[model samples]
Each structure stands twice: as structure tokens, then as C-alpha cells.
Target: MMQHCNKMLHHYIQQSHSNVTIKEIIPGKLQGRIASPTSKSYAQRALAAALLVPESAHPAGWSELRRMGLCNDTSAALDAIQRLGASVRYGDNRDTYYIEGGFLRQAPAELHIGESGLSARLFTPIAAQSPTPITITGHGSILRRPVAASMVAPLRRLGATVTDGANGCLPLTVSGPLRGGTVEVDGSLSSQFITGLLMASPLSEAETRLLVRQPRSLPYLAMTLEVLRTFGIEVTHAPDYTEFVIPGRQQYRPTVCSIEGDWSGASCLLVGGAIASELRGAGIIVENLNPRSLQADRAIITALERAGAILASSGHLWTVGRPATLRSFEFDATDCPDLFPALVALAAFCSGTTVLRGTNRLTHKESDRAATLATEFAKLGVEIDLSTPDTMAIRGISTSDGSLTVRDPRLDSHNDHRIAMATAVAALRADRPVTITHAEAVEKSYPHFWDDLDTLYTA
Candidate 1:
């Protein structure tokens, strides 16, 4: 299985060099079940925590991780950890990772995070724990996003010396024996750096007190806290997540854990199921998702419910089908901004106008998500209004007759994974085939996305 997974990863890497054109869907209902991909969100946090564990705590100081994600972002996290001096090896199944933590003894001169924004932010503070100077860099869209306020400022306040690349972005040279104390962090841009701080603070000689302002994506913070707990680290926080108190000089216990299934990736599949389900039949069943996950994107269920999509769940299985009539629904996605792309696709098939708030959070993502979604979906005749600063109003193309005509069959993914999946899902109900450039962007979070979409048709 490990060899198979590696081959699959190699296959996607090769496909990324060319375009993947999705053929038009004929009049047919989607069927079959696909397991949700492992949650990279959980996997990354776990991997970072594993790097801090003492070898004395467990045999050879190894932390076992199961159900690891096969996405580029998680891959970046793995690579970042290895560069920082932790040893990693895969089990026979390739689904389990045995990480021997000991990064403090030796620090790499450079850490490249690839295109993962989360890795760039989550590793900055973690990397700052080293007394030696370490340069953090990445490729693709991540280099273009601003990080000064979210990452550099806070690390500097904690006694880390940080040099910005050019315009306060990546390629940051950071050095520190990070001291724990009271520090203020602006949380409006992202919560990833805050997670980094929480994980790294335990190594400081003094206790850490974080004063976070304008915190967004609180659910993701909860997820970080949960991972910290699993590794036997303690963190106390304010009820509203405005402040956090972490004890210093704490040790991370090596433990075996399993990552949850990702709702972020499953969202596109669920939207596809809601859009393509027959009037009377079993809809698409997505297995392995936790209904009560702390991940912010779990709000997809609420949006589906608001849109009047039929949903039923038993244990880890969720089935989504189109209702007798789909209605445009209002959603506030400030905390779960990643859901915007999938929700946009779901709204495209609903009647009337759907208003989604949290446009302010979309600017620093893999792409300018709000602008990209509007631009690409318009090619399918979907009307999206972005004139309002904090809101996006999408006027749905009435699919009363079961299909909508694609205004232009060609589109672009803007090298963003969510955008790629969203466009592919929207095309399921299109009158014509849609061909998307840079479609391989799905490898970022969901490496098997195209394959899973195919299962719906072939089944």
C-alpha cells in the first residue's frame, strides 16, 4: 500500500505539468461511496508536535501517526520536519508514520514549505525555537501572500530576530531562543501562526501568555488545542479565544494517534452530490468524515441544510442528495473561509440569490478566492456580485430543468486547489463540458479528487 500511495503521488506530480480537461457529464445520477481524505489540518499539527517530543518518552522517541493525508500541504509539513532534524519513516501500509523527534540538537539552514500557506505560518514560530538562524521559504502562491503582521511581528516580540523577504512575505530568515511572555498577535489575517506559537511556547523558560485580537477561524484554533492535548501538552484559553496561557518548559509525550477525515476536501464532493443527485434515489455517500470535527469547514453541512439539500448520516457516513427544489441560502463564512468555493458551487444550482459573508478573509488565500471564484464561475453563466466589501452575492442560474448551460466551456484554476475542485463540481450539472487549466491544483489538499469524482460516474 505504501508503494501504491507513493506511485499515486508521483502520478499526480507528473500530471501537474499538463492540463486535465474534465469531459461533460451526460444526464445521469451520481452513485457510489468514497472515503474522505485524511485531514491535513490535523496531520500537520500532529507532525509539528511530534518534532518536539523527547526520545526518552517513548522507545527511540518515536510518535506514531495513522491515516496521514497524502496532500501536498501535509507533504510539505513532513519535509519541513525532516529538514529540521526529525527522522520519519512510513509503516508497511504507508498510512502510518513513525516520527522520531529530536530537532533541537540540529537545525537546518533552510526549510522550504512548498505552496502550503499553513506550513509557512505554522512552522515559523516552531522554527524560531532554534537558537541558530533558519531561513523559511516556499514556492507558488504562498510566496505572494503577506505574512509580516501575522508571523514576523509576533515572533520578534518573543525575542526572535526575523528578516522579511521583500514585501513582508516568505523567504524569512528567523533566529531565536524564543522567550515565553506576554505578547499580542493580530489574528484577523490567519490563526496558523497562533497555532505555531502554542506548540512552540512550551519550550520557553518562562510561561507564555498570548493576547489575541480579532480572532478568526476559532475552530482551527480548537483543532490545534486538541492536537496539543493528544500529545500531552496543556493549554488554557479564554472562552472566546481572545487569550491563551501556556506553561513553559513542558515536555511533549510521544503517542500513537489517528488523523480525522478532512471536511474541507469532502465539501466539494458533498456539493457535487447535492447538485447531481436524482430526484428519487440514493445520493453520493462520503465515508469517514466526523460530524463533530473541530475543523472550521464542517459548516458545509449547515450550508447544505440551509440550501434545502437532503442529508442523512449514520456513524461516519453522510449522504447528500438534491431536494425537490433548491433554494439559495445565506451563510456567514468568516471563521470557515475555505468553504467559500464549495458553497459557491452549491449556490450556482440553487434558485434566487445567495449571499455569503466573509469576503474580507478571502484575500490572502491560495488565490484571491472571492475574485477568482467570481471570474471563473462567470464563464458558466453564474452571476456573482462582489461590489459589497464584506459580502459576496451570487445569483444562482436556475436549474429547474436539471441543467444549466455553460457560457464558456474553458476555465482556469488559478493554481488554487479549492478553485479547481469547485469548478469541477459546478460542471456536473452543466449543459456542456468544462475544460479547466491547472486542474492538477487539486493535489494540494485532495490528491485523489479527480479519481473520486470519476467513481461517482462509473459506479
Candidate 2:
């Protein structure tokens, strides 16, 4: 696996297939329309299916195993499926995945998460379900990434033994009976850890209860619930995620499922459209997003509107074009840390400055997102101050022209996909070429990100 890591990491960059980096972005106010890629948030649902469902009849696997969208991030999820003893073969005419399920046996010797935090964090509790020991590892910026400490204590209580990197971090090893029971978790951190446990428990012998304390991003939990139901697993949650009941021995039904397009990645396009809408006479149009989606990143619409972008929706199609004038709007990113980069890009167009709170949670992301945002923006003539560990204040550049060279040539990915894409977007606004050293990190979610963005809007 380590060899695969070394090969994959070097393969993309050295071979110039890390995908294309934007040489320069002349922001003349983009006057075109574009559609975002399939949702990774939805794609992982298929992975969970492949893990728990079997392809046979007479109570074979999860019933909803059908054709689904294949995106870069979801491909990582499918890879995790392959490692867990499941057979994944795609249809020649269709990207359908035929998963032979029931892989609750011993885990692989070592589980490598690549550069995907979603795959890393979500797969942790799933790995704990096994009686045999599993070693979880990743490459790129993963070693420095912070997974919520909330994941540790519960698996311990469940009788699933675990260990972390130097400090509640990765390269974790866990051996478990995974005895299910009530445990406390902090919602203030990423909701993924708790979501992992919720999804893992039905396969356990004992029923489980999860009590969330800080619960910052609750919407993601809701999405997890939706997936659980879709996969034929049953979990009941009280109003606020205060309590969750995951029944044991629930049979997973096999059926096909479709993944949604990502609202998170679409944010960049929306911001670009909003910034240029006034000059172009129309904004951006996005499809397949649930107006009531559990993804906190869906809140981009609110942020765009607050910043004075005119937003109107027809059916599931959402449009964010030109705004009369973009203004600074303060955002509290306590719940959706993933939105920080797109929000920062959006805030740059505002007058005055924008301050985002809850930046303390960024250390675990692809880059130390707060620091990364500050550093990248500074190179473009935007200044950011980290007053609190979790808060950032950015002064906007009313006007920026010409190339803005990134100060540090060898920038770290922090193994977070959003950071990689965020830096690329930042480059699109500059005059000179914005070359990202390890740009392949974008594959953790949006594989065609640069391809799509470059089509209508050139950098």
C-alpha cells in the first residue's frame, strides 16, 4: 500500500497528470454558465452499500444497490470497498458497481485512506467492527490532518480497542469486539466520526446509543441518516442528534443507488458566476441539489445572497449570477469548515473585510485551512489575521490585476481535497500563473474540477 501511495503521489505530479493547474486567471467577470459535478456526499452511500450488501438473492445484500455516479472522491470510497474484501467490477456500458457484500470478517492488514479524510474518518468505525486488528494509514497531507477526538472514546467503550498517532491523530491502529453502548461525542468537531459509528452499529451484536455534545454540523448527520435508510439500515435519532439508536443484527438489503452532485464543489462555480453575473447579464445554474439538503455546504446560497448576489431557483436548478454590488458579510463557519475556502473566495469580492469564526477546527483538513487560506490570499494582495485560533479576518482587494506568484513554491496539501481546489480557485483570480505543486489532491472529491472550471472560464 505504501508503495501504491508513493507511486500514486509521484505518478500524478511527475507525469503531469496531477491534472492541469491554472497558469493565470484574468477576472474579467465570467459571463458564462456551467454545471457542477456529481456529489461525493451522495457517492459514499454506494461505498457503504458495497461494504454491507451482497449481490445474491434470498436476503443477499442491501436492496438499493443500483447504478450510481462515479466521481473522483467516490472512486476513493469504492477503493476502500475493494480493500475490505469486497469484489467491485464496473459495467462495460454503465459505471454500475456489482459488489459481493458481507465483508465483516477480518480487516485488511493495513487500511490506507490515501488523501481522503472522508474515507479515512468514515472508514475508522467500520474498521473497528472487525475482531482482528486493522492499521489505518494515508498519504500526502493526511499525517498532519486532525480527525475529531470524539471518535476515540466511543470505540473504546464499545470494547473495540484503538490507538492514535502522536496526538489523537492518524496512522491509527484499532482492535475491537466493538461492544455497542452509549457514549458521548462532541458535535462541535466534524460530524463524520459519529456518523461512522452510526453506520457501523447495525452489524454489531449489541444495540448502541450516541449522545452528541457540541454537534457543530448536524446536517451531515442527517445525510448519514438518509444514507442509512437508503442502504436498508435502521437508526432512530432524537430531534437534535442528542440521542441515536442503532439496532443490532439489522439485515442490509441490496439495491442500486444514485449519487448526487456536490453542493460543496459547486460553490466555487456559484461564486464565480455571482462575481461576474452583473457584467454577464446572468448568473450560474446548478442542478440536483436538495433545497433541504443535510449538507451544511448548501448554505452557500445564504452567504451569496447576504453578499448581495441575486439568487433565484427554478425546480432543482439554482442560479447565482451577477450581483449589483458584492459586499462583505461575516460568516460563522463553526458547522461547515469545508466552506471556508469558497467563502474566503466569495468574501474577497466584498468591500470592507469578512471575519469567519470557528477556524480552530481547520488543523485536521487538507491544509491547515485557516493558515492556508490566509497564506494563499496574502499572495494575491489580500491580508488575513488569525485573531483567535478559530477566527480569521480578511481585507478584500477592491481590484487585483496581473500575476500574483505563490510565495512558497513547495506548498503542502495537508491531504485535504478542498484546500487543493481552493488554492487553484485563488490562482484563477490572479494575473500570473498559479501553479499548485500537489494539485492531485482535488481527486479526493472533484476529479474534473479543473477540467470543468477551465471550459467556460479560463485561467
Q: Which prediction has the highest lDDT against the true structure?
A: 1
lDDT of 1 by residue, 20-45 (tens): 53323333456778999999999999
Q: What are the lDDT figures for the candidates, one per model?
A: 0.86, 0.69
TM-score of 1: 0.94
Displacement of residue 67 (Cα, Å) in model 1 is 0.8
lDDT computed for candidate 1: 0.86
What are the clashing pairs of model 1? none
Please give, for residues 212-259, the per-residue lDDT of candidate 2 as tens digits. 886767778888888888777898888878889898877666667766
